[model samples]
Target: MPAICKLARQRLHWLGLSVCLLTLAPEAAHSQDMREVRRTVRYLTSRHLHGRGYTHHGDQRAAAFLARQFKSLGLVPFKSAAAYTQPFPLTVNTFPGRLAVTVDGHKLQPGQDFILAPESAGGRFTASVVYFDSLALGQEGARQQFLAQPLQAVALVLTQPDYQRIQAQPLLAQKLGEARALVILVPGKLTASLAPRQVAQPKLLVAAPAWPHAARQITLVLDACLQENYRTQNVLGYIPGTARLDSLLVVTAHYDHLGELGRHHFFPGANDNASGTSMLLQLARHLSQPSHRLRYTVVFIGFSGEEAGLLGSRYFTAHPLFPLDKVRFLLNLDLVGTGDTGATVVNGTLHPKEYQLLQQLNTGPASVGPLSARGRAANSDHFPFSEAGVPAFFLYTRGGIAAYHDVDDRAETLPLTRYNELFQLLSQFLTHLAH
Candidate 1:
């Protein structure tokens, strides 16, 4: 009887050990699985992708690659979608002719020394560089001061906070009448980064240069010409659900970047968006099985023309292949590769419950750390969905790499240390949300 009791106790001990090991196994394996996340980031952000813009066929190649990945993962095509590709239209403006700027007899090359506004009317004149301190609309005194000047030569107006608002009211331009030319200098405060060419407004007019100017002698050279037709596209794929076919949880990432401008220049956009696109592919693969019993369908979208005023997303919302009203939530991944410090959850303040749930899930064995929250901002692809009243959130790593919108934002420079934790947290969050 004593021997039998001892044997039973040993069996119980062994059972307890097995359970403990099984519980720890997932975490151990997950830590190692993070290497795959790093690998994905590396591949997507490789130079072979070439900034993923339309002009270089980089965007199309990226779309095809993503589609292949989705197919491999066994994600079924959404209804009426042939092979998981959703085509959209876009009009991109590019510089086709020689764009030059000569200030005080100093010649400047396009993009390096100066960028021609796509809408500027091409002409030439010799005008003094007039400086407008602040062009606020309601400031009647400043408006009068600007209009009263002998607007002959190039008006080199410095940009101010109220410039956009005042410019939105076209009467301000009418009041100033015509000058030799207009040279708007983006203020030192606002000129810290390169503004994306495709997204800027059509404030300037495009024309060939025959040197048309109201004033004479001042060679106000409007050396910019527009290539009216440029192409870009948005990539789409989907994984069908079992029980809830009506509702969808959309995952999106923009795969476009600022293309080359001059020698030794290209915005690689590794952390800016390639990181996010790779995450979308990973999620599609992770949730591919039909037996997973998803409560909502999953859609993966790789948007182009995101650098151009959310153009891809806007087009999708306008001409949706799937019903927009059926979309329950959107998770837009932007920069999730390098969050060693933490990550920011935009729209968290708008959806506190979901944010808190994510926070809680992130506090476990795969802790990523120091998560921050921000109010809803129309800064990324999630903006369109939120505007359409669909619940959405944009996730991005908070720190580590600050080389955004520059050539320095390369894949090899990315710090993907916390990507595994982020992936686990997102996977858990999706699982919980689906339930």
Candidate 2:
């Protein structure tokens, strides 16, 4: 028998799984877990979870599910934690129901035809449409005259550029907020995000082609609520090391997504984060095996409120379950569903030695290339950890579906092209960390 297999068998003999381990090759054993990974992604993105957002308590449900997973894996909760969950509060704007839109008597689909701005307020209005271009709204005098009219009688429809300009001009934006509603025509995809507060009036983003050229009237029925003190949590657990237990290696991913865009429209977020969360879970599963235990403690964190601007990770850094300084290295994974062209390591340029090690470790069919490197970014759960002086890298796959922050980012559409390759790379990297 090979030395590696013999070592693994000896370690696993205590659990009485040596025969089972020796029967399957390493690659086969790893590949078997891919089924579980896909199932996890699908379950997290399922309609019952409500896009895993704030609506219908999807995030809360997800947290509970992850806690169960941790317990089953034999990961221990921090002694100071609230039983594997670190709870926090956030205020968010949510569209729970009553989403209807019609332009010139043509009822449009929720995700296809339009999307409310994240901060849009609830309102019902049927009024005349007044279209405005950049040139028409350029002069301050024209905006003043427009705001002077009976705002309730009109829903101002502005070109995308004009809408952006008005938003930048706070005085004009506040004045325009008094109108029945602001309809902005987007020439491309309609992306959505989370918001902490609601605006004075509803802002509707209509696909340019969906809007009739000579539309006379518009009707909007939206129900929005500014949910204050919304309770959410960061799910975390850890495996103690056999040797350097005081030092740590952390893996993190955010499980919260854009959630539902009303009653019917939901962002599945398969790639944006479900993929990363799956990787975190998979890594935890691998490390928890008796034969795979490492020298440094491995901490796994499935953060919430990432869509709300990394609130969960920020809170953890501020009120950490373990000493922040003890974290030897941290890897933050996000948007890793595809790898046709390769992947990029954010903050790689900042840590050249570690980047070189990662590049060196990835080889054969498992290599993600052209493995690129990037500088610092505040784009993922890694930002807070890096800010807290933890050596960190945010890794994400590249060259696949462009669906992001939309209703189309479903599990069915996610390619997961190089999931196995990425998983191998992570496992190898973790092993190297022990030395």
Candidate 3:
């Protein structure tokens, strides 16, 4: 399948006339720089970075690395800042220690067979299992009987669907706090995330197939901590425009992910935003070149705290170093690792002119696939800028590996199918912006 996709991309590459032939800039003639992108992705996914999350100072390490990259690229810091760093505060719940689970005397591996809920609290216990279905919860008597289970002595096991159903009901979800722990059997990939606050109840998410169907007892030991006022930073730099130095064009990608789960396990987050961050670095490198400099200042921002609810971007929007009105356009990239089928542009419908411009540049068979226009969405770093009245678009490539927010989204598996094509498309788009 990988070979087939590579062949298709090669065919697509030959079908389109080079944008350079259309009298674009000299930089448009450069070949796709896949080596740098791959290197960047590999480094970002390395375990040394601790999954770029809140624990182990992962986000801070990433920020420092980006600052060094910006300096090496010859990009300058935002106006008046001592360096290319904008520090901010974040409060997040993190799991940084032992995360063990045992079912019916069978020990399970962390991250592979199970993951703790993002907001789950720490606990060490062996509890008797009480399996329940959604239908059982519907009955008043059964509900009361279940809620009456002795705390610290019982563990409630529910299917993913039943868990979702209970979560939807505030009363039932709160009542669940009475149990010693909650176990959710997920039939699919084990996803991880960040939580703003830690809850009192401990929760375990086990792979459905890994859970013993007739299990009677369970043992779990989770060590979690909630950090307050954790100081992190956003990495920012820019290339000065040749002509309109005051007006700005901005590019952003979050560099944070669901950091380390424990001392030994971490989420690689290759496709999550590492791909986007690497692309942003490439953009910075491209624009910083003398030949590719545009008419307006081009700012590249590697935002942290995105996995913690877009905190970095929200802080920047609230206390913008430069005047917000000076920003002509902003493009936020995430999940750009794969492009087997197509891509989507958030807020495309709200700004038809920009969307149409992308469409014009995306003509020819060389384009990856369909470029779907979507309405306003508060899904990425673009949302705060869009809400502040700056024209912004959140772009993400689709269709490749199913790995996401899980342990499997590693650099080894990222296909980067349409990376070169999308890079070329954006280069042309920037050339048009120069006019």
Candidate 4:
């Protein structure tokens, strides 16, 4: 099957969570600089960055990298805007030091036999094991009873099906966390994530086959901490418009991704927002040119803590450098690595004028492939601005690879399919904005 067709089918199957691992056809290439996009993705996904998560100050490294990119591109901070970065603080749970788990005499491996819970409170817990059967979990009355009861002993173990059911209700953690420890039997693989909040009890996962059926107890040691005021920043740069000084256009992409799973494993996030950030940098490079400059000032932002929440953009819109009313329009990009089928626009219906303009430019023989419109969503950095009454749209490329929030979303595997075309389409639309 053709690569585009396969990606489209897979994308339809995955419902907006996918990536592009196929090769970019040379004949499809355009003048837009994909070399820089490739280079940026490669460096960001490199091991030293540790998936750009909070685990190792990789997020700070990512912020610094964006600042450097902005400085290199000759874009300057708007008058009221602070230097380059607007730093903020957050509290999060992290497992950077020691992580270990064992049931009886058998050792459990991270992301293999067992995994530590992201929200797990850091501690060492050992006690006699208690089991919760699938029948108990499947029964509504028993499940409610389990949630209400005070768990005693070292750890509580559950079958794979029970574990999945429990995971569906995040608030269930409050109950589970009251236990000394919680254990789940995973069937095959485990992909860990950064937990937004904390649970009082430590949690461990065990592989189904490695589960100690006869074991009386379990032991888990995790050097995790709920670090408060963890500092991070957003990187911003702008090109003063040649025409209207008061009016402006803002373009943005979140640069944060799921950080280190442990010491050895990290999610690369090549297609998540790194691909979108690469697009932002390329736009900065292009729009900075005097010949390509716009009628309204163009602000480019590389947002942080987007994976944690829309923290950076929310901060900026709340404490905007310039007046919020001055922003003529905002376009936020999340995943732009592949456009095998086309691109989808969030807020297309809410902001019909801009959406119509986009449709106009996205057609013709040299079109930017198919364009799909979606209703309002708080799905990306655009939401905060939209809620603040600023017209904003988040655009993400559709169809490609299926890797997301995992180690598989690598730079080498991304195709950059239809990237040049989308770049052209956006530039054309920007040129006609408010004209």
Highest lDDT scorer: 2
Find the 10 residues in a row with the least total lDDT in model 3. Answer: 14-23
Expressed as tens digits, the lDDT of each residue in 247-302 for candidate 2 is 99999999999888779878889998999998988888788878889999999999
TM-score of each prediction: 0.69, 0.92, 0.91, 0.82
lDDT of each: 0.64, 0.85, 0.84, 0.76
Ranked by TM-score from best down, the candidates are 2, 3, 4, 1
Candidates 2 and 3 compared: the better one by TM-score is 2
Summing lDDT over every window of 10 consecutive residues in candidate 2, give the lowest-scoring window.
Answer: 14-23
Best-first order by lDDT: 2, 3, 4, 1
Candidate 3 RMSD to the real structure? 7.2
What RMSD does each model have against the real structure?
A: 13.6, 7.2, 7.2, 8.9
Report the C-alpha lDDT of model 3 over 1-435, residue by residue, as the tens digit: 467446534433432222123224444433445655776787778777789988877887678778877876778897755589888899999998888888899998888889989899999899899886566468988777766656556898888888888887787787777788988899888888888898887888899998987999988888999989998888898899999989998999999999987789999999989999988987877777777789999989999999889999999999887888999889899999999988899999999998899998887878968899999988999999999999999999989999989999999999998887787787677767767
Which candidate would rank higher by lDDT, 1 or 2?
2
Query: What local lDDT score does residue 278 receive in model 1, on the 0 to 100 scale?
Result: 74
Decoy 2 TM-score against native:
0.92
Error of 3 at 309 (Å): 0.7
Flag regions of model 4 displaced more than 4 Å.
1-32, 79-82, 102-116, 125-129, 137-151, 159-175, 185-193, 204-219, 364-366
